[model samples]
Target: MGAGDDAGKSFVTSGFTGTGGASAQPPSPSPPVAPGKVEGPLKSITPTEISKRHILSKIKRGTPSDVKNTVILPHVDAEADLAAIKNNQGKWLGGNKYEVNGRIWGLEGSGAIYPVRGDGLVEMNKLQYEALKGLITHEGDRDAMAKDKRFSRYKFHTTDEDWNVAQGVYDQR
Candidate 1:
């Protein structure tokens, strides 16, 4: 039957279903949380962040590099204030598009939030279709990145067929 059917002794259907008139005790209260020493409004940009969308020069691999450096309408209303993301995706060893994003993270101990502009790049490799897919992997994890001051000059090399590694430049202000 339902709960607390003590061999049909008492037809109790409420919470106090004691076998021989014994009441159940409620659970104890939880411990109080410790006070936090440091508080943060931590903000990290993800694909959901759609922060700043810009159309950089999509220079196709050709003789004079067909550059589209002008006439780009900034979608900052739905985006942010980044005019461009210094793209370093040039002609790849394979026939694919590599994307690098220069992002600036706030120094943890510092109270600054200005845009220092650091770019990270990832190759689509004719395979993956996301812009920043292999960026951190191509570059390095956050710790490896933090320890190595040369993150600005960091470059990733993979023999992935559709993934074209670039020999261009990144802009991390």
Candidate 2:
């Protein structure tokens, strides 16, 4: 069709030869599936972390409800990044680059955040973890959160067997 072709309900040629329909063709390349493992206990985020968030919340603005986290584990040169972070700080600038979805979102305030390093997923678990931390007012809230729809689908890999038990109904015949 020409550029003038009006938008409509449509499909694609997919560039595959002799297709009876789109159904018979293989889907695009995909990430490999990870092997399954037995579930583990509901690992607590820690009492101290909850307290920290509570204090920070009183002083800071954003609440748990207002945020959704995306963990970005750093996947690059630890030493060089740390040096960059330090150099950036000496000059007063942005932090080291952390790759997420293959893009490096640099830090805004500081030059470097060299706490954790090497083959790790930088910032990946941070925001969500902090949000979870902010939500832990007491023990019971944690229990309710297990059944929380917003968080249930995102079963922490740490919560092995418990996650399976909690998630079992959907898979049943």
Candidate 3:
């Protein structure tokens, strides 16, 4: 083609141009998600359900009988102790009243008194237990705990036995 012939030809571009050609419109805003509703391929799960599944999966993996015999029983026992402390809140010594050795004690209820030490190993009474529970159990507490190294294992290994058993399992793994 000659140079003059090229001047009569117009060039076409792939996208929008300011010369009055069609332009792409912004995508319409998606409707806001309702409070509990979720979208996309991923599904939301509750922490309780996740914990249940984790326990179930561990059990399903079939530990050596010796490990189960030795480790499982002690873990269960410690769990029972924790449950007792949690359920019988009355047994806790400090009910906004008593403080001993810089720690609150639950004096009233009848159960083996697991004392809360400065190291955060256990709670002396229900009140202390509840306070610790409040710290790690809620989002606010979890966030605050994440910032401090002292509270790293505050939620786990509350009892010496539980801590030992957890350590054993961890070491074995």
lDDT string for model 3 (45-84, tens) is: 1111111111211322222222112111111222333333
Looking at model 3, residue 89 earns an lDDT score of 22
How far off is residue 163 in model 3, in Å? 7.4
Q: Give all candidates' CA lDDT scores.
A: 0.22, 0.27, 0.27
What tens-digit string does per-residue lDDT give for candidate 2 at 1-173?
11112243121111212212111123233333223421111011110111112121221223342232222121222333333222221222223344322223334232223222112221213333432432433222546665665555554642333222212211110
Which 10-residue window of candidate 3 scores lowest in summed lDDT?
A: 45-54
What are the RMSD figures for all models against the true structure?
A: 27.7, 19.9, 30.6
Q: Quote the lDDT for 56 in model 3.
A: 12
Question: Highest lDDT: which candidate?
Answer: 2
Q: Estimate the TM-score of every prediction.
A: 0.15, 0.24, 0.16
TM-score for model 3?
0.16
Can you rank all candidates by TM-score, best first?
2, 3, 1
Clashes of each: 16, 17, 11
Say which prediction, candidate 1 or candidate 2, comes out ahead on TM-score.
2
